[model samples]
Target: MATPEDTPSQSDSTLSGCIRPFLTKSGLTVRCQSRVRSQCPSCAELYRGDWAAIARSGVFDGPVQNFRFYLLTLTAPSFGRVHRVPKAEGAKVSRCGCGARHSVTDANLRGVPLDEASYDYAGLVAWNRDSGLLWDRTRRRLRDYWPSVEFFVVREWQDRGALHLHTLVRIARAEAPRPALLGESARTANAFSKVDGAFVSWGEQGDCQAFRADGDGAKAIWYLSKALNYVLKDAVRASGGGARSWGHLARLSTAARMVRCSPGCVPRDCPSHTHTRYGARGHVVSASRRTKNRTGWSFTGMTRKRQRELRSEWVTAQAARAESAPAEWAVGVLEARAGRAGRELRSRVDVLP
Candidate 1:
């Protein structure tokens, strides 16, 4: 819905390529752009690795996992409502903060304030910037309250353009705090900060829910994993620029990391790929190699269900399908060893129909 008025445009694309489309086993044709070192015949895409890793993390396991699991959502307070689709085509007309009812198709008005004059852009941007600090402090405080607890956090942006966090926190069953107590701790963590000579807080206290992890893993993990799907929304692709990735998860404590893989691809004796642990003022106390962003800006045009399936087999399919024609092999005995393992890897990672 953006008009090409304020920003200058009109240059022909020097990058004269289009996203190549390919057919998948599920009867879906995926559109993906080729990357330089990509092995996937169809080009590597988003979330394939992230979901697998998170699921493999065992936080969602009902009894086997040692830590208690909880789902928490931290949000930016609303300036005003814009427009949204009703439950039915003409279910009900809800008034915006400005008192006028918005039409269903007025979806373009989602993030922008109903009355722009009153919206606080500076406050919103500041909160977005300092959110990493806020989260770090909150994690430390949670640990202080119960020394042995741990957490895994993920973040997503809302259609309203506010950065809301989706966290999978882990604590021992006996140490699990009451919902109200945890909520109070979260709000308490958001006490005032002086920014640009005016005081501002995170504004919203946020939401929390407990994950029972008792039912189908595919069903139970859906709520936690689907939060990542927000990156797939059109609003995110166009406007979310650099914020598409997790900013706070960058320097997350190594002790509190979300384990992404069990029997992970990295071989034993391989260089470690853990995160860099940063101290209070943003100094690195422990070091690990920096990694690239996980979520990307693209229109996969896949449904949420299809997206979920990709989490399991997407990377495996890509690896199996990759053209590794110039195969590395050792002399006689080692070559046999390599071939056996390669076959096993391929078999384990084969795409599910």
Candidate 2:
């Protein structure tokens, strides 16, 4: 068996020569010029493959679709926080005082591009399976809080490589509704509270944001592609083993490590740089309003703020209407007005309504 001593130091020339073929093939010769090449080709290959797959797959295609877009980000209740390997430091390492060196147990690794073990695989699977339901419930809540607000559901991956959701909600050019009138029949603020089977916790809650588009398909595709890239494969440790040992050892090692190294360990800077770039670009262009009048607030900005205020007002108005009139009648009246125009426009286009 190869002991830690047998494992080449990261700076070893022999190891570099051994991994030369893989390094060359991966086109990593450029990006890796500054750092000592990783000692383990197997691990390096795993890292290279994951990133390569994302790049090759055109994951950024969606985000590039529209100049203006909206993205709803959701985070799940942590199964528990896990420690991820830092990108700046490369992979983790375990060196004992006795000079006994061990590759950092994969269990200790976390964050993106290192190990997928830090993710809540079970929670992710569950969320993916129940995403449709979760979306429906969330939509219902939003509608109850602001009758005029509209939205649609789409699946998205969180920074931690787990499945979550992106809801494109439409706030139209209509009078503001009360916060009480937004989704189904609950307070707009509490829409998510009623979602059943949702593992809700206050630690990290979900968020919603909108952007104005230049009105192009390319921009929409860009956003979509970027969102899709967040879906990452499960992490596998880098170790040498025969074909026979691959499956069993991979599973056993990761499983054993999960106890000490919490799976689903999103970094403090989770969602990775890919998502961050998209956000930075989106915010730069879309967060502000583009108004007909140069001095007025950007249309997108004004629209978003108005939408919030309207939802609150609409909800309050609806509640008042409900108290004075028949509850069913009041709801019907409000629903009818909300359904009038922007519904179809918001539903069809990727642009924020």
List, residue by residue over 11-73, the lDDT tens digit for candidate 1: 111111224556769975554433211333223233333333443343433343444556666
Question: Per-prediction RMSD in angstroms?
Answer: 17.8, 26.3
Candidate 2 per-residue lDDT, tens place, 1-353, comes to 22223222333322343443335665433223211124544434433333333332222223323222345555445543433423334555555332434343432333222233543544433333343444556555654554444333334333343444444444433533332232213212222222233453211456544444335547555554555333232222233333423443343333333321113433243443212221111110112123443211122233434543564576556445555555465456556657865688677788755
Candidate 1: the clashing residue pairs are 53-260
Of candidate 2, the 10-residue stretch with the lowest lDDT total is 279-288
After aligning candidate 2 to the native by TM-score, how far in Å is the CA of 296 from where it should be? 30
Mark the regions of model 2 whose C-alpha exceeds 4 Å error after superposition: 1-69, 86-108, 111-131, 148-152, 157-161, 175-205, 215-225, 228-353
lDDT of 1: 0.45
